[model samples]
Each structure stands twice: as structure tokens, then as C-alpha cells.
Target: MSNPKTKFSVLMSIYYKETPEFFNKAMQSIWDNQTLKPDEIILVKDGPLTAKLDEVISIWQEKIPNILKVIALKSNLGLGDALNIGLKECSFNLVARMDTDDISMPDRFKKQIEIFKEKDIDICSSWAREFDGDETNIVSYKKVPKFHKNIIKFSKSRNPLNHPATMYKKEVVKNAGGYKKMLWFEDYYLWARMIINGAKFYNIQEPLVDMRAGFSQLKRRKGLKYALYELRFQKELLEIGFINIFEFIRNVTIRFIVRILPKNMVKCIYKLLRK
Candidate 1:
């Protein structure tokens, strides 16, 4: 049973490090450009933010403060914990996850919502256009599976869902134990858990989000410490039966090499191999 007029909530978290310009753009894309506006928006302030960030928030508050629910965390919890907190505050059965920097297209919500109304999907994500320097010079498009069976199979090797472009049933997430503190693998870990628990997943065939990409994105993926975190993620999946010990070791081996490689090399491989 689906409501054609179902109103959904947008869940987002903002930290001090994000630039105000990109933040404003993301906000404008959601509130000003979307074909169907969100009913409620649950935003978590991860920690103290700059004056510029505050000013941008204030502007949004002045525009539609009633539609916004702001939750402030005393300390900087990472995305997982912050989102877990925000989830409890969201008042909709359908919740759309939004990143602070990515821009959703005008019809993004309209199209996603229609799918929810027409299908039995527990989580629905979409393709994304990755851009760097400028949106005009779009580098690559991230295309994902359009069916549940394909998504589950793909999840064995890598995350099948596009995180920021996803709209999920809130109960599905809560039942999956909400998001956890998995360092860099928070979203992937949650998706993996949901899949093992028999959550139905889908992905739209068209790009609904413009993912911000560039040097900073590449920089975050390197280092020995990151490799260690990735290995920990794989081991947890093995313990949960999402992967076997053999698959776990193989994942760790590949992750260690990829995570420790130079940023330029990683970027080259991504651009060359990533479709």
C-alpha cells in the first residue's frame, strides 16, 4: 500500500569543514529547484560550525523555518552517529538521505517518490554524475543496478547503492540498527546489513544527483590507516555472513592496495575503470 501524496523527510548532516558556497548550492537545489518539495527536513549540526555556515542556515530558517527541524550535537560525531540521531527525529516513513555538497536535480524527489508509490522497494537509489572543477566538465557517471537481485549480487563485491542519492523506508533503516560508527564504511556497512536481513533494494536508471568530485575526494581514500579501517569493515561483514573468510581476505587484500596507492594513481584508475 502506497500513498500517492506521501510526504517524505530529508535527512542531512553538516560539519564545520564544508564550504558555505557548496552548502548553499545544495540547499538551493533541494528547496528551490526540486519539483516536489520535501514535507520536513531533519538536519543535524554535527558540531560547531563557522559563522558563514550559520548565516546560510539562518537564511534558510527565515525562508521556511517551520518545515525544518534542526538538531544540534554537542560534539562532532561522524556521519553514522549523526545520522542515527537524525533518524529518530524524522517524522516520515520515507526518508531521503542528502549530503551537504551534492546537488539533486529538479525532478529527483518527484521521480523517486513515484517509485516508492508504485513499487515495494525498501531502499531506492539512483545514478549520479560525477563532476570536478565545474559541473560543465562532468567526468563520469555512476550507474547502478535497476533490480533487487542484481543489487544483492553486486553488493558482494562493492556497495551497490549510491548513498547520497538514496531514499529509504525509515523502518528498514531502524530495523537494520540504524547507521553505525564504521569509520569510512558506515553507509556500506549499513547497506550490507540491510541486504542480509532481506531488504529489497532498487536503483533508478537515470542520474538524479550531481556528485561533487575532485582532488579532496581522492585525498581521503589514501593512507595506511584508511586501509586498516577498510580491513576492519570486511572482517565485520564476514562475521555477519555477508562474505566468507576467503572473500573477506580477498577484499582486504584489494582494499589495502587501493587505499595505500597514491591519490593520482587511484584517480587515474577510477576515471579509467569506473563507468
Candidate 2:
């Protein structure tokens, strides 16, 4: 049953120039999830709408009466700015994040809200599978416990909560100053800021999303750029005292191993354990 007191606003910032099919899949997943239908579905089109995308959005707008607003940007602002605009327009107390090229499980929002109510958590997220074009090459992360201290441990290395799978209290986000216009990795920065502001986080141990990887422009960029971002991220975390030297070394080593491992092997291991 939907909780009337806990209305959720789902914010999807999309640029469907390349993969309209994936965007449709993502939106359908949310629409099909009956237990936790969003009070308002805020789709922020980050650039001028193409005919194909316009048709899709129009159909959805008519089919889903809950879709409260569609903000079509006249000019392209990057993802961070687009998300900020979406956040500003949300009317519900709980805000959920969605990505254009991912598939969310039907029970995602229901499970997240249940956790939020039970634990009084400010932010809730879940584990997700990374599918590299092929579903056969799906990989998942270890299930972290739902505690602020445990979550803070992984903050220095990589994002503890999958960005697309996260749901947060709207007021908590505003209090933390919302998303910043970082060059990249704005989600990670936002998580760090939220944690610093004494917001509690929880990760439901389930594969709530299937995120397609290695297809975006961000993935096509030179490997050196990603390395530089990680270096900067690590430095910032270290300065903030979230990670010690030993944890830092361990985290870096694990990431290195994942990079070299065969995609299929990683997928198999993850699926086996996740089940």
C-alpha cells in the first residue's frame, strides 16, 4: 500500500539523443512499480526535444497522470545543473533519483521507503548490477549494512550508495545545499556533503537496478581523466578524515583488480553471491 504521508517525487534528468529505448525502459520500470508510485514524476529534458523524444514524453504525460511537470531546457546545461533544476521543482517530501539508461526493479521504492520508516534514515539506497551491454556480463557490489558508520567507511573509496538507486529526504538535501556543479562526479560530492551534515544513510541489500555501463560519452573519455578524478576524490576524502591510510590502500587495490578482471568472471561471481 502506498503511504500517503510519505509522498515521493521521482526526478529523472534525461538527454535521449543516443538511447531512447533505454530511457523508455527506465521510465516503464518506474511506471510499472505499483507499490510506490511517485506523486510527481519530474522529467527534466536537458536539451531541445527531438521528434522521437517528444513523442515518447507526450505519450507518457498522457498515460501517467502522476507526471506533474516536464521541464524542457532551451539550452543544454550539464547533468549537475539539470538535476539541480529538477530538485528545485520537486513538490514531495521524499525525492528519488533515476537515470535515463537504467532498469529499476519494481519493488525498489517500496523497499526503500520501508527502510526509511523503520530506521529513520535520511538517505536510502540499494545495491545494483552493472551490465556491460550484455546481460551476461552483469556484476554487483557487496551488500553493505544499513548504518551511518559502516557507510562512511566506503565513502573515501567509491560511492557507497549507487547514485541512481538512492532516495533521500527532500529537506535533508536542501539542508546539505543540494548538488554542486562539479566538472564530474557530482553525485559522489553530494553524498560526502550529506554525510558531513549528519544525515543518516542506509543501503538495502538488493539489486534494485541494472545499470548499463561503457556506452556513455563519459566512458568514452580518455582513461587519464577518470584517474585524475579518482585522485582528486581520494585527496578530498583523506583531508576530511573519512579514510585512513590502510583503508585507502585497500580500496585502491580492489579497484585495480576489478579493472583487470574479465567482465564475465566478475558478473558470474556477483550473481552467485547476490542470489
Candidate 3:
């Protein structure tokens, strides 16, 4: 209720395989913990979830009544499509992204809204503290540059913002072509398009969200399939002129090598890369 004048919508997509306990905690962080509550929370059920997940949604629905909106999909659509669909249903111009298994700091929205009010930026995300079993036990910090120009330079090599900790202008996202189906690089791909379209970007230096990260998450980053996805995404960026041939070549070569490496090596590399 701190920034009641600046209303925004929370957009999240959850599917099966996510535990109910994590989902409940995510829901709490967005509402119960936040200083500036969202006008509406758009929960896109990517597909049929477990009875337990459904039960948790039911409990929240009754608890919040009109504030929580559920858009259940008939079948499983991946994160990009699910978010694109949910984006259109959002009631506000500003939309904050959340994951089903992450934790947002209590002042996350308040801080981001202040940036939007003061700057001419379209999208912004803060640094995220990656944790494992408990929120207090921080494993690493996924940090990004603070200014738009630095962010633009950084995007050529890596994602310049944390997706789940982001709050973006809905129209800016739509104008940049929204989210696309880019497998493991969905968010990064959309960001490349937005950068090409000259959308302003910023990142807060402090960690505004606590992201859940572990060995399983690191393992998912490897394998032949993920390497292929990275290759395709880099090719798309090159084709769109977002990155030059040399940049594309460098990206593909490094990312491909990392993806095909052993999971333990990948973990160490990621740890070193992150703060």
C-alpha cells in the first residue's frame, strides 16, 4: 500500500513439477511481504497442475477474492508463450514478473516503481541473491550493470537482467515483439529484440529478489539439446543484426563449449561468473 498511486500487475506462469510449498511461498512474497501490493495478480497455470497446486490456488483465491486472477491453459505451453498470453490479460501498464519458486524482497516493487517514476526507462530488474535450501543461505549473486548503456553493452554477451526480479512496461514489451519461443533463451531472446528496438533498460544494484538455484538448475543448462538451443538463439540474434558476425561467433563458441561441458565444471564457471 506504500505506492498505491502507481498500480501494477504481477504476472507469473506455473506448470506441473513445481512443488506446492514453493508456490505458496512465492504467492506470499508478492502479497503478504511486499510494501506496495499489486492491483491484480495474473497467475497463468501453464497447464494442468497437481491437485495440491490447485488446492493452494483455491485457498489463495478465497483469501484474496478479486485480486488473484487465474488463467488456466488447456494444455502445456512453455514459459514464453504462457507469459505472452498472461501479459495481454494484465490490467496495468507496469507488469512485474515472478517465478513459482522464488522469493521477492519486501520492497522490490516499491524500489522499481521509484526508478520508473524518475527515469525514462522501459524495463528494470535488480540483482538477485541465489539461494539453495534456505533463503538466508545465499549461494551467489546474479548481478547486472546499473545504467542503460552498460546494459546494452552487456546484453551482447549475456542477459543483462534477472527475469524473475524484473518489472517492465507492458506496452514497451509488446512493441518490442513480446516474448518468443526460444527454449532456454526465451527471456534473453526477447531482451535482444527489445534492445534492437531501442527500448530503455536499467538494473538496480541491490538484490531485490532471492532466486532458487542449485545443482539441478545448473545441470539443466548443459546437454546437447541446450547447446542446440543456444546455437539457434545466437543465430537469430546475428540474423536480426543485434549482434555482428564476430560477436555471434564468439557467443556461440563460448556458450556451446560451456553447455557441453560437465555439470561440475559448469557449476564452477557459473559460480565464478556470478558474485
- Candidate achieving the largest lDDT: 3
- Residues 1-275, candidate 2, lDDT per residue (tens digit)? 85556778999887756477777788888886546778888999998867887777787888886574899888889888999899999998889999988878888888888887889789998888777776457644435555778888767666778889999998898898888766666888888888888999888877787777633322342355554566566666667766777876776666545444565665554466444
| Clashes per model (N, Cα, C within 3 A) | 0, 0, 0
What global local distance difference test value does model 1 have? Answer: 0.89
How do the predictions measure up, each by TM-score? 0.96, 0.82, 0.97
lDDT string, candidate 3, 1-275, tens digits: 45448889999999999999999999999999999899999999999999999999999999998899999999999999999999999999999999999999999999999999999999999999998888788989999999999999999999999999999999989998999998878899889899988899999999999999855578777888888988998899999999999999999999999988887788889889985
**In model 2, what lDDT does residue 56 have?**
77
What are the lDDT figures for the candidates, one per model? 0.89, 0.76, 0.93
Query: Native-vs-model 2 lDDT?
Result: 0.76
State which candidate has the highest TM-score: 3
Task: Report the candidate with higher lDDT, 1 versus 3.
Answer: 3
Would you list the rank order by lDDT, best first?
Answer: 3, 1, 2
Worst 10 residues of 2 by lDDT: 214-223
